[model samples]
Target: MASFKIEGGHKLNGTITPQGAKNEVLQILCAVLLTPEKVIVNNVPDIIDVNKLIFILGELGVKIEKLGSNSYSFQADELKLEYLESENFKKDGSSLRGSIMIVGPLLARFGKGYIPRPGGDKIGRRRLDTHFEGFIRLGAKFRYNKEEHFYGVEADELFGTDMLLDEASVTGTANILMASVLATGTTTIYNAACEPYIQQLCKMLNAMGANITGVGSNLLVINGVDALGGCEHRVLPDMIEIGSWIGVAVMTKSELTIKDVSWDNLGQIPNVFRKLGIQFEKRGDDIYIPEQESYEIQNYIDGSVLTVADAPWPGFTPDLLSIVLVIATQAKGTVLIHQKMFESRLFFVDKLIDMGAKVILCDPHRATVIGHNFQSALKATTMTSPDIRAGISLLIAALSAKGTSTIHNIEQIDRGYENIEARLKSIGAKIERVA
Candidate 1:
């Protein structure tokens, strides 16, 4: 596995562009399987997971042509449906959680879809029950084989129906939406995930001639269509990367200008950072964070401890809470970070605590961090990355620490962030990638 050896306490200054959305592109790439016509997508990030999904699509006989550095044209002109039964499918499909999304488009267009047990970050138990349940409600036969460890959904014809998801699952909504677009009738999905990723997927689908309504809302109405044509779609900038940049600026006390961050779509991210007493200026489409000597956390008006938690869309994203927690270690006041989505995400705090930050892991889901306010530098040490988000948070912590730090399992980081070391190095960050 590759690792990063970082020299800490470097003041960085430069302009950086946030990469295209990783989660959004995951869904958009899967949507290509729903149409046989050519679909062009722009602003695609060149990362491990995205490339893995692209390779999987190619294995299914999707004709893929690279248009540019950040663009690709894909056509499912002649799919090799039998490839799903091959060992190659099991090896490639099990490498990414995003591979599960292919099931929807395949089942919708070819009336059958097969997925091997998918693999991803081991933060928590990410169940596929919602996806299977949605497919079952859409008149598909769902079966799971424990021996082979795969899932299969098949139906001669899929018809739309009403479904209230057990939870607002992002992938679940995207999966069911893809299946419903080619279904026979109107499908009403309540408690749907309305994240920006989902909204972007719906927009791209509508452009491809799919009837979808109530975008950016929890209730979705998808009118089934006979066929979907091709369309060109540009993914929005990654909000998680933007938020990570913000946290890095504050933690390192560096000046940075993040360009074209799609300010309007960031939802509660800016406000949540503001609550932590981090300030930045918005210059048209860019965000300028000035170098700060120190930043302090804000307490609630009732003099209670400020708590940062995750929710669905239009609220704080769970993906960014780790960044918020790591930056909080250098602030002036105390705050609680409640990671509601994943149980094991907070386990990395022990490494942070060992680095001299004051932290209390109250339980599996909550941690209280006491800020150091630049009064002292964190002593760096060697650590292993637990997941993609946690890996970045640890990198940020190491960057702000006083001594050298080494982070292992950097493959987890590369799976999401595109050319992360190269990008950060351009901004004067002291990061060296080692094999």
Candidate 2:
């Protein structure tokens, strides 16, 4: 396993370009199965999950050509759907949650799809009942054997209809969108996930000839097309990475500029961070975070500690709450971090506390952080990463701590952030990867 050894308490000062969205790239790669013509996607992040998805696609006979750094041209002209039953499929498919998305495109074009239980961050029990529910609504029959943990879906002719998702699950929305694009009739999905990733998928599908409306809203209407043609599309910049950089700047009191950031896509993030006394200036498409001596946490109307919570699209992303929590430790006041989406996410706060952070794990879903204001540097220690966001949060904490810190199980960090240590090192972060 890879680990990060960081000599902390050094201010990070340099320019860094945020990588492309990992979530967007995964689904966009699956979108290639919608057509036989060539499709080129640029600004694709070179991360572990994306690489795993590419390996899985290659095993399925999709011709993927690397054009340049962060660019790839893919052609699913002669995809061998039967390869999905191979051991390669079983191993890779069950290794990540994004693997479930292949089912929709496979079923849409090949009339059958096979998937085992998808694996991802162990934050909570993410139910796929909504995904299967959407598929069954489109006239597909599913059979699952719990003993083998395999799921199969097939339909001779898929007919679309109106669907009201029980929850606006991101992967569930992508699954339905891919499947509905090729159905026999129109499909209306209400309470859908309308995150930037989903909107990008919809735009790419539209360019490929699938008629979709409500690009950034929770209601999506899809007019099924007989066939989708090929088209080139570039993914938008990752908003999560932009937010992470913003947190880093505030936490380390460093002046940094993030370029090519989609200001419009960063809905409510700037405002949310403002509540935590972090400010940034916008220069066209870039965000400039100025150096700060100290940051103060804004209180609520009743003069109590403010709480930051997560919600659906157009709301603050839950994935960023961990980073925000780490940043809060450097601010001058107390704040509550409420992670409504994942129960196990707060458990990692113990590691931060062990490093001399003032934190109270209120419960499985909430924590109260009192900033030390660098009164005392966090002592270096050895810790294990728990999940993707948590792993990155620990990395940030370790980077801000004193002396040396060793973080194990770095694969969790690789699952999301692209070349994180390298990127940080480029930005003057003293971190190295050790095997």
Candidate 3:
């Protein structure tokens, strides 16, 4: 396993552009399969998970061309559908949760799709029921091979129908949207995930001739199109990475600027950081965070402790809660972090506790953080990364702590963030990758 050795108690300077959104990239890459024409994708993040999905698409016979460092053209005219049932597919598809998205396009275009139970962060139970449930509603037959732990959906024809999703699952919404785009009738999705990423997908589909309305709402209507043609789509800046950088700046007392952040799409990220008293200036689309000695958590209007919780879109994203939780260690006051989406994301706080943060784990879902207010410095210690978000959170903790610290299983971090060590080092961070 690869590890990162960080020399802590240092400040970072200069500007950094956030990588393309990893979550959005995953969904966009899978959306390319809905069309046989060449779809050019720009600003793709050079991260492990995204690269893995690219490799899987190449294996499925998508004609790929590298137009630039972060640009690619994909044409899925002659996909090798049989490969999805092979043993190699089970291994490849299971390694990435994004691979599950491939099933939507395959089932829509080829009448059949198969995937092994996909693997991802061990944060909590992320069930795939919503995906197959939506598929069945559109006339597809779903089957689960319990013996092999595999899933398959097949249909001779798809007819769009009105349905309400059990939950606002992002991937599920994207998958059903892709599938319904080529269906025979109109499809109405209630309670759809309308995150910026999903909105981008809808825009891309509309550009490719699919009639989808409700770009930024809980409801979406898709009028079936005969086929989709080639289109160029550019992913937005990674909001999670932007949040991480903001946390890093506050935690390590650094002055940093995040460039071209696509301000309108950031939702509640900036305000959430501001609620924690983290200061930043919005310069056009960029975010400039000046050096901060310490930040204080803001209480509610009625003098209740500030509670930062994660919900669906327009609420604070759950992905950055880990970073917020870690940075709160040095904040001036107390705050409650409720990671409602995932139960185990808070489990990584034990490592922070070991490094001398005052945190009370209320339960699997809630943690009350009593800030050190920077009076007591966090001592460095070795720790293993539990998941992608937690891994970045720990890296921030290590960078802010005194003394050198070792972080094992940095591969988890690489899956989500592209060349994180190099990026941080460019900003004067003392971090090294060890084999």
Candidate 4:
């Protein structure tokens, strides 16, 4: 396992560009399997999870060529179907949750898909029932091998049908949409996830000859097509990283500018930070956060404690809640954080509490944070990273703490953020990576 040793209380200045959206790249790369022609993707982040997915595709006989530092061409004209059943596939597919998305495109184009129980963050119980249910709704036969712990879906032909998902699950929606794009008739999806990532996926698919409508709403209508072709796509900037940078700037009293953050798609992220009284200015497409000694939290209209909660698209994302929670430790007031989607994600607050923050874990899903407002700096300590978002959150906390902090299992952070220590170092952060 890798470790990160971070020294606290350094002010950062200058501009940083957020990496390409990780979630979008996963779905987009999976969608490339739907086409037999070359699909050139731009702005693909060079992170471990993404590289793993690319390796999986390469093993499946998808011809890949690197066009630039962050661009690649993928052609799935010849695929190795039997590879999906091999022992190697089981090992690779089980390592990352994004591998599950490949099932959709494979089933849509090849009439069969197989997945060995996918693995991901230990945030909570993330059920795969919605994905299987959507496939079943579209005329696919779903089977589970209890002994091997494997999932398989197959159908000679898929006919489009109406599906109202139990929730607006992001990966679930992408899977269903990919499966339905080439089905025989019209497919209507109600209560769909309309996040910018999903919208971009739909747009890219439309460019490749998939007839999809209702781009930015909960309801999507897709007309089945005979075949899909090649298309070029550029992923949007990572909003989660932008939010994390905002928190870092606030915690370290730094003046930082994040470039081209896809301003319109951020939704409530900026406002959510503003509620904590963070000062940021949006100049054109960039977000500029100025140095501040301390920030105050804003209460509700009735002067009640402010509560920040995660919801579906157009609402504050659950991914940013961890950063918000850590930053709240230094804000001037109290706020409640509700991470409704994942139960155990809020449990990471114990590490922050160990470092001298006043936080109350109400339950698995809720935590109340009372800010220190910089009256006292957090004391450094050793901790283990539980997941990707939490890992970065702890890094932010460590950077603002008083002494030295050592974080183990930094591979979790590397899975999402690209060369995080080098990026932070470019902006004057005192972070060192160790083996």
Candidate 5:
């Protein structure tokens, strides 16, 4: 296991470029299975999850060639569908929640699909009912085997139908889109997740001859085609990483510029930060954060403490709630963070409390943070990463602490952030990787 040893209380300066979005790359990679031609993808993040998905593709006989650091060409000319039942495939495939996406394309193309229980963050009980329900709506039959902890789906031919998802689950929407693209008729998906990642997937599929409308809204109308052709697509910038960097700049009182940030896609993030009294300047597509001492939490019109919460697209993302909570520790006033999506996401507040922050864990999903205003630097300590977002949040906390802090179980962080140590080092952060 690798660990990060960070020396804190140093200002991060210089311009940093955001890496490609991980969520987009995962869905796009799975979309390759729908075609037999070569798909050239650029700006793919070299993160652990992407690498795992690439390994899974290689196991299925997809030809993947690396052109450069962040460029690759993938051709699924000869896929071995039986590999889904292999023991090795079962073990590795279960390691990521993104693995569930393969089921849709495999079923749509090969008439059968098998997948073990997918694994991801243990934030809460993330059920796969929505995904399987979408598949059933598309004329697929599903069988869940409790003894083997596997899900099997089969359909001789998928007939498209209008689907109104119970919830706007991101993975569920991606799975349905992949399956509906090659169905026999049109499929209208309402209450879909129109996050930037989902939009990129839709755009890439459309470029490959799939007719999809409503790119950035809850209603998506997809006209199923016979087959998808080869297409080249560049992944969008990592907005979560951009948001994390914004938190880092405010917490450390640093002047930094993040280049190539998709300004329009950063929905409500800037205004959300503005609620914390942190301001930035937008130079074209770049965001420049000047040095600031501290930020004060804004109150409501009734002069009550403001609450920052997560919802569907256009609202604050639940993924960044951890980073926001950590940044709140340094703000001038108290703020309530309600993570409505994941039940156990707020449990990491104990780690922040160990670092001397005043936090009240209201329940499994809610927490109230009282800012320290950097009155005193957090003392360095040993910590273990619980999940991906929390791991990065702890890293940020360690970077702003007094002495040295050691963060173990970095694989969780690697699953999301691409070359995080290298990226932080570029901005004058004193961080080292150790095994």
Candidate 6:
């Protein structure tokens, strides 16, 4: 495992640009498997998870070309479908959770898709019932091998059918939407996840000649098309990364500018930071935060403690809760962070506690943070990264701590953030990778 040795208690200043959306690019890259024609994607982030998916695609015989540093063209014209049953395929498919998305396009075009039980962060229980159920509802047959932990779906043909997703799971929605686009008739999906990333997927499909309506809403209607053609698509800037930068600036009392934030798609992120009394300005598409001495949390209109919780799109994102919780530790007041989507995500607060932050872990799903109001600083210590978001959150804490700190298992952070050490260095932050 690699480690990050960080020097804390220093203010950083300069501008930083977030990489392409990791979540969105995963879906878009999978969609490339739907058509035999070449699909060009721009602004692809060079993160571990995404690179793994790209490697998988190349292994599958997708005609891959690197057009530029952050652009690629993919064509699935000569895929090695037999590789799906190979032992090497099982190992590759199970290594990353994003591999599950490949099943949708494979099943849609070739009438079969197989995947081993996907592995990723141990954040909590992320079930695959949503993805398989949607496939079954579309006339596909599902089977599982318990001993081998493998899943397979097949059908002579898939016909359109109306279905309701039990939860607004973003990956589930993307998988089902990709499968539905080539069905025999129209498919209506209720309670679909309408996050901006999902919306980008829908728009990309539409660009590729699929008929999809309700791009930004919970209800999506997909009219089946016989075949899909290739189109060039550019990914939106990552909102999660943008929020992380905001937390870094506030915690270190640094003046920072985050460029090309795609202001309109950053639903509830800026406001959530504002709730912590962190001030920022919208300069064109960039967000500029000046050096800050202190900030105070805002109470609710009813004089109750502000509770920041996660919901579907247009609501606060669950992915950024860790950053918010960390940001609250240095604010002037108390705030409650409720991570309802995943039970174990808030468990990382124990690491923050060890760093001398005043946090009360109310339950598996909630934590109350008592800000130090600039009166104290978190002392540096050795820690391990639990997951992607929590790892970056701990890094933010380490950057603002009183001394040098060490963070192991930094691979979790690399799975999401691209070129993190170099980016931090360019912005005047003291962080180094230890081999």
In candidate 6, which residue pairs get closer than 3 Å at backbone N, Cα or C atoms, i.e. clash? none
- lDDT tens digits, residue span 216-300, model 4: 9999999999999999999999999999999899999999999999999999998999999999999999999999998999999
Ranking of predictions according to lDDT: 6, 4, 1, 3, 5, 2
lDDT tens digits, residue span 1-435, model 1: 899999999999999999999999999999999889999999999999999999999999999999999999999989999999999999999999999999999999999999999999989989999999999999999888899898999999999999999999999999999999999999999999999999999999999999999999999999999999999999999999999999889999999999999998999999999999998999999999999988878898899999999998887999999999999999999999999989998999999998999999999999999999989889999999999999999999999998999999999999989999999999999999999
In model 5, how large is the Cα lDDT of residue 39? 98
Write candidate 2's Cα lDDT for 1-435 as tens digits. 989999987887878788998888889999999899999999999889999999988989999999999999999999888787777678779998899999999889888999989999989878899889999999999999798699989999789799999999988999989999999989999999999999999999999999999889999999899999999999888888888888777766788999989888888888888998887899999999988878888999899889999999888999899988998888889999999988888888899999989999989999999998777777789999999888988888888888899999999999888888888888788899999
Question: How much lDDT does each candidate structure score?
Answer: 0.95, 0.89, 0.94, 0.95, 0.92, 0.96
**Positional deviation of residue 304's Cα in model 3 after best superposition, in angstroms:** 1.1
lDDT of 6 by residue, 116-204 (tens): 99998888999999999999999999999999899999998999999999999999999999999999999999999999999999999
Regarding lDDT, does 2 or 4 come out ahead?
4
- Residue 31 displacement in candidate 1 (angstroms): 0.3
Stretches of candidate 3 off by over 4 Å are: none
Error of 2 at 304 (Å): 2.8
Candidate 5 lDDT, 1-435, residue by residue in tens: 999999999998999899999888999999999999999999999999999999999999999999999999999999987788899888988998899999888988888878899999989999999999999999999999898799989999999899899999998999998999999988999999999999999999999999999989999998888988999999999999999999888878899999999999899888889898788999999999999998888999899998999999888999999999999999989999999999988888898999999999998988999999889667788999999999999999999998999999999999999889998999999999999
C-alpha displacement of 152 in model 6, angstroms? Answer: 0.7
lDDT of 4: 0.95
Task: Give the TM-scores of the predictions, in the order they appear.
Answer: 0.99, 0.98, 0.99, 0.99, 0.99, 0.99
* Overall local distance difference test of candidate 3: 0.94
RMSD, model 6, all Cα superposed? 0.6
Q: Give one clash count per candidate, in the order shown.
A: 0, 0, 0, 0, 0, 0
116 in model 2: Cα distance from truth in Å?
1.1
Give the residue spans of candidate 1 off by over 4 A: none
Model 1 vs. true fold: TM: 0.99
Q: Model 2: runs farther than 4 Å from truth?
A: none
Worst 10 residues of 1 by lDDT: 293-302
